[model samples]
Target: MHGDRGLTVGGPPNAQSPPSAADVRAQLDILLASPAFDVPARARRFLSYVVEETLAGRGDRIKAYAVGMEVFGRDKNFDAQNDPAVRIEAGRIRRALTHYYLAAGLSDPIIIDIPKGAYVPHFAWRTEPVTDGPAATGPPPETPAASLPPMPRKRIMWLGAGLAALATVVLLVMVFLIPSRDAPVPTAQAPMPGGPTLVVMPFADLGGSPETKIYAQGLTEEVLSQLARFKELSVLGRETSRSIPPDADAARIRRDLGVRYVLEGSVRTAEHQLRVTGRLLDAETGAVLWSQAYDEDLRVRGFFAIQDDVAQKVATAIGQPYGIIARSDERRTQAGAPEDLEAYACTLRFYGYRAALGPASHAAIRTCLERAVDRYPSYATAWAMLSMLYLDEDRFGFNPRLGSPTATQRSIEAARLANRLDPENVRGLQALMGALFFTEQPVEALRVGERAVALNPNDTELLADFGARVGQAGDHRRGMALMEQALVRNPGHSGYYNGVLAQLAYLERDYERAQLLMRQVSLEKFPLYHFVSAIIYAQLGMKSEAAEARDRFLQARPAIFEQWDREMAKRNFRPEDATLLAEGARKAGFPVADTTAAETALRTAAPQR
Candidate 1:
């Protein structure tokens, strides 16, 4: 029976009553009364399920299911016996047990543990006193017959065995009848403990012509890109996983990648048709999990149909191995209007602008994006790219023809428009942030940058953009951490991350470290790296290193005076920033007049009223 506040049961009512059912009850009362046993209601219910399952043992598997169904209301369409969700719930229950022991401050108490392969929980009394010998000489003098409980008879034992066997039969049937491992267990929704590893082997050329080979390469990249979007399966990188050599050992590859599964495939382009063969293998036992071949005539229908088939096959393979959370949201969707394609293509060209530095390069990118925006007025990416070009002009001193102070105002307007068009786009948000910070409106952008990160933690581009802006805004340490996370995601793409690291090294007053970074930099590969590296090394007292950086910087950027004039037009132009570049050239014994003249020109260029 139960009441509003508490309940009284007959079993083990007192601790000092010589181990009767009443005594067990009384010990439980003491445990419940203590402040140490304070657990939330949900945690308490989960804990209770564990306790009863352990006490009942093997014959009581159905009882475990009953408890789960009643507590969690999850038995519909789900078989507790074969479902992986049941096993995962058990794992969570195990962690909760550990939490209880630590949180309760139990110096000496009874303990329970759940064994693997069995859903039941087990309890053992730690507080029970140990006897020296196997049995006592005689029964207790004060023992009463009424208080003692009788042992199970042979008939009862037979009945329990029969029930246990029935439960086992049900478990076996459930395991066979279930179609997949993704079935949810009663009580809690939990993910499976493990999933498979998959690698997309490069597709073969199929003895095709040059144009066909290009199509084959595109097909190969498309498959990899789609698979990478799924978070459920571990996928090998494109660089490390293409072209599995003829003698390649699937078993060794699986072992090295720490995966239990491997996917191998080949593609052949014949006529205007594409034929593909794919096989999934259980690497541990050399068993084929699945194999299929697909043929499609692309010339009749177009390449889109073929690309769609490849994406579907990849999604199906990943879902089959890992129980069905894999999805293909990143796949491109064909737009109704042709201008969207033009805008996307333009964005790629603007991205290429990173390699091109100076007046001519920036102008070319601006022209390309301007035309794209003219064609597609609502194109989010094109507008954002245009904003970035304008912002770069002021931020990096790229537009020598336009005065810096007025150019910054122009950049601010462009960035605002970009943000207005595409608030969700990381590039757009970053462009707006740059405009705000330089225009003395950093507060909102910093807050929004942090919010953006919280929302998209896995996005490396957002992390890098946010890090650079925050570093420029003076939160050096936080900025460094954000950039480090970006590097961790894409290790080989170090151009932007390396430049930011060089700047951070300068901030910490580590001159030698700054100079070391400058030497590793390749300006031809990344022009901005050289520009930032030059200023940093120059300030760090490394004259030779600074001069090398300055020479490359000037070589890549010939319009030094005009660029300076454009930058000086921006608010909060620092003398030290120019000094770092100028003083380094002087220390390296280069003529100082050109540097000073450029600096003076920048300072003098103000927007007309």
Candidate 2:
């Protein structure tokens, strides 16, 4: 006989009779005691439930949803299609059965097999050896029980029997003492230390066309990358999650990746329109966290817009503040046309290139922003991006011809145009603040940066930049507070955030904390990181460390010392403040020059109220 899932039953002709009910029960107990069944408690429970149900002739009633509710403790209303716990467990159980048969149970007298695609188990007797082909048919001779060797003398025979009995008992005890060959090996779960880890699964292509498949794949990668930018969330890389089976259950994903949340979605492209639908689930419990559907015209801009919208929705679903939501809502209200879409698309490309940080990328960003502004001259966002591009080039030495003065003038003009186009443009104000700072208008820059923060406190980059600028302007305490708040909102913020905190610490004379904070900054990426660190170590009386830090700073940027002096002069620091920093650097073993006269003149020429 065979089970519905193609599992064979019964034994060979020479094999023993089929196992009784009690025998089968004993076998199950022994198997459960083996290492093969040492799975998660829930998986073991599921396996036992299905096997017992089949033994009771209830295999027909063992449906996916039934197993989910009764065996896995899921709600009675669990949807079998959406939550694939039963199917996933069935696969795991099948693998466990194979493991048992191949290793510990290889020579067992009976076999238990759970065939694919079914909950029923098939029981069969082990085959016996055969000596001849089908042509041979003969009865074998039996040994005579009455034939035996002559008995020994009574006393000697009794002594031999006693020793034999003792030896048999010892062998039985040894057999019982040895560990079972089929015990399950323990597996360690991967550590997930920070915020809950989430994996955005590759989106399914509902349209079925190759084009639609490529589009869906691209959308999935884009969404994954966008989610990674949020420091509040720990997102798994696309390479780790792209190949997840479409029907994989939450428990399987949790077991494999140790993730708490799974985001799955589908994309469909039709005639001139696209629709995206997504759902978030609690991977351990198979509970739906959130789901949404979006529809838009089928265009590149529309696709990007939907991708951004989905990422924002997922972040909000997981308890993040919906800052992007507010920004997008404001953009929609301000610019209600297709032209704004094109400009926003261009700005998105510009940011992508800017992050690349290559010379070609800088040129590409400039081109993108210039075209964006030309296409929509009144678009405040595009103008702001262009202004920021100029400032970045000047600050990072991306272009040799664009000197500080020329870059500062261009940036200020673009920022003014952006603000004039839209007074409520927060990004424009942010760019204008940077321009003002570079142009030696410290008071106005502080005012503008504060206004930008007031408009959007959730902008992590703005908060960090503003905090640094404000601290440099001699208000260390308030600037440190803002930066700390930003860290709370974004614990995984960039290294620059750490550098700002270190700078504030140095300003407050907290040498130890400043030293510790500076260690978090990348010296290669921010050469000034070493400068502040050197000053902190010198102040802490660590002469060797201070000298080493100063050497590293100079090695990274030999001209940084001169650049620093010029920038400090532009900021017009107070005489006492300049003296303290200069003295600290000198004590740290830096070759310092006299800037006391310049500092004195700036202090004496105070502007009238």
Candidate 3:
């Protein structure tokens, strides 16, 4: 007898006759031959094995461990949780089956589905539309009793006994197939390269107040910043790690960030006392490497001391030498009490908004800096950040309300005040360098940038930014070396950092390396990435690819070509260097205006030599 939609379910007593074993085997063969199984050889083999096992009444034995060893060539000792091969293959099979049912097997009478959260296969009869055709109008003509053959009573009894036995096996197997919660957790063996990499997750705010949240964030940043200043460690940036979900597991962290360790913490405050607890976990094993608790007065100095102590302990725990990690003496003194706390909290908020990279965020950063400076006029870091904010506005052509000239002037003034207030502040030096670079003093900018890098060679972010700026100022070799070291310290840095390296490569006339480096940049987030990609592709003589890249750039930044001169000037790129980029862009099919005219205009506007 046919099941729903003419599907022949296989089993049998004489009542509703199931499809024969031979018919089910034939359907399995058809499935195996379909395009759905056209994946890698191992995956195809895996799919075939699972289906055959289920058909042979061995479905309960189809666990991940068994599949790994049987089909994927994994060793007999393979741990399903530790090695993801089995899980990965199972996911591929599920997707392949879905693709098949949606396309090639849309009208197939039988459906085979692997339910998620378990690997067991389920078979169902596919429903088909009923038609009002003449064949269904009346009952079929009856056969004469003489023409029908009768079944033997012995054969009927044997078939009934076999069906009962098969039913009992299926029921027993179903019980054994229920998933167990005590399975081992998966562990990754891929070692983190170039020393240990750590991601500091945002601190949890247990204090339940909006004001207390600021303190938690500030504490996290303080610790992260201090830890990042060690040459022996590779630390992921706060902005990158903060995006991880609070409930994410160690496996997820390893998969997403490829870090060896994760630093997590929470803060609690009551009256004037504060408690901060932190723990470091092995990303591969989910084991706590080290943990510590800090109890202090809820004052800025207390917080700084706690951060310093924790950084030192974590470094020592991770096998870093004692003397190598910089002490927080100078920084702590420079960023002292009440006023520093308030200003630093504002700066943290400013950074949060800045990471969003929108016009509104830009405006918010300006507002935050304004308040910070207003509240603490002597806070050099706040003034330095304000300077950088203006420089960023000028460089990226953001916040057009503050015209380039006004932005440059403001940047210069803020940088001067920052440096005057704190002569040893590396951030102030960086701000001064940027402002000087934009104001047509490349020589001074290079000097200041070198000073900043000298003061804190272990600061990855500073090294990367300073390297990029100084490279633009004509010290390409030195700049590249600094950037290379920065990459070594922070391997999981954002795409923008890679883009800076790509630009340096382009300047050095290494088109191949430049093209390779550009791959790390996200074209959707940075249209300039596509523009540079177009130039590199053009230089490499890939006309079709170059044209495609150019189209994408134009689609994202429609007026970039027309605004090229203004952009170059705001970035303080040398006139000759600007001309080179413009020429390459023209060659790549960009509709850039004549740079010679802009060059002559610059010459006329310059003071007599």
lDDT by residue (183-203, candidate 1, tens digit) is 111121111112235766666
lDDT value for model 3: 0.64
User: So what's the TM-score on candidate 2?
Assistant: 0.43
lDDT of 3 by residue, 1-609 (tens): 222223223312232333334444444555654433324446667766877788788999999988888897788778898888787667756755765676656655456777877776776545432322344456545867645543332233335445545744553354234322211111211111123457888888998455568777877887776666543355776766678898998878876556667888888878777777878777878877567787777565665576665554443333221122111211332365333244445555454443335456667767767775654444566778788888766666567543334677777777776776567677788789888987778788888988877766555656777888877776677778778866765554556667777887887889899988999877656665788888888888989989999998787567766767776765667665776777778889999876554476557768865
Q: Where does model 1 exceed 4 Å of error?
A: 1-340, 355-360, 399-406, 531-542, 556-609
TM-scores, each model vs. reference: 0.40, 0.43, 0.44
lDDT of each: 0.54, 0.64, 0.64
Error of 1 at 350 (Å): 2.1
Worst 10 residues of 2 by lDDT: 183-192
Clashing pairs for model 2 are: 35-182, 35-183, 35-184
Q: What lDDT score goes with residue 375 in model 2?
A: 44
Report the error of model 1 at residue 415, Å.
2.7
